[model samples]
Target: MPAARQHLFLLCLLLPISLSYEIQLILVNNCNYSVWPGVLGSAGHATPEDGGFHLGLGEEAVFDVPSWWSGRVWGRQGCGFDGQGKGSCDSGDCGGMLQCKGAGGAPPATVVEMTFGTDRSPLHFYDVSLVDGFNLPVTMAPVGGGVGCGVAGCEVDLNVCCPSKLEVKRNGKVVGCKSACLALKADKYCCTGDYGSPKICKPTLFSHLFKSICPRAYSFAFDDSSSLNICRASRYLITFCPPAR
Candidate 1:
């Protein structure tokens, strides 16, 4: 082949590799006690930090995931793990394993869900969901400013005022606040069956309370639009027990 043709072929081979980008997720623990952060990736997506790991007060963990990554993260409390990564947590336990692997954390645990962008359309979506319930305060925000990007999370601790019927107690202390749907298991609360649609599944009193407390967070399954945040950033920060503004 001619020299020019060989050079063109080499450039084409490197094009795809140069266009790829990885997103960085920084998980911070600001709680007074220790926490075990759990990560669960979506189908066909790799979980960088899939196994649960320990984070003491003021500690943090950073993970680099593919640009097309999609997953959920949560914090586990009161965990007791053996040397073999076998253990249990008071809240958000993942089958008594230190590393959650592919297993999801048990409720009532505050969950941070995120879906990164693809090369074709580079838009990242993220939200803090209370649909399962809330064990700790969590905030998800882009590391740097991005146009039209808003933060999503619950800054205040919900366990302080959790309704008696919805509180999860451990050692006589409220550790988590269950969503009404989880507490009631009714179609109206769970937004299932006939109530699956947004129009039919209006916010309940409990959801209203949650929204009033944390306007940026998703209080229920149908809570979207306002709760969901879209952005295009290389890095994001998910903080447990986020500091008060």
Candidate 2:
């Protein structure tokens, strides 16, 4: 084969590898206590760390996810796993297991969501969502991903100010805050049925309160205009129980 043809063949063979980049995520537990981080990859995607793992106070966990990975991360508190990894948590429990293993955490749990784009569309979208309610303060910030990469999270503890009706208490102490949809189970609050569309599903009083406290997070389903953040970064820092801003 001619030199030019050989070079073209090599390029073709390498194209797919170049397109499938890996993204690094550094998850830190900054809370005063230990936290079990739960991961739930989107359908058909690979779940890292077997879906969950333990992170002691001041400790961190790192993983390299495919650029096409889309998933949600959350923290489980007050957990107790037996020798066989069978146990539960006061908040964010996933089927009473230490390793969530593809299971989603039980709300009310603070959630960090990320959807990375493939080579065809390289933008990464992320948000700290309170839609399932808040178990702890958390933040997701890009590392050295140039300007326009906004941070998404809530720095302040929401459980402290959680409304009485939405509080998830454990042992007489508030551990999580439930969304109105979870607390009331009303179609209007859940944005179901007649209130499904963005136009019809405006923010409710509870969501408005959440927005006021955490402006950078998703207070409801239609909070895309402000809560959704876009960027292109290979590394992200997700801190649970992040310091208050």
- Write down the worst ten-residue block by lDDT for model 1: 43-52
TM-score result, candidate 2: 0.94
Which candidate has the highest lDDT of all?
Answer: 2
Q: What is candidate 1's lDDT per residue for 24-85, written digit by digit as tens? A: 99999999999999999989876666568999989999989989899999999999988998
In order, the Cα lDDT scores of the candidates are: 0.91, 0.92
Q: What is candidate 2's lDDT per residue for 1-245, written digit by digit as tens? A: 99999999999999999778898999999999999999999999988999889999799988999999999999999999989999989999999998888899999999999999887788999999999999999999998864469989998898999999999999999999999999999989999999998999999999999999999998988886688889988899999988776
Q: Rate residue 135 of model 1 by lDDT.
A: 94
Global CA lDDT computed for model 2: 0.92
Which 10-residue window of candidate 2 scores lowest in summed lDDT? Answer: 143-152
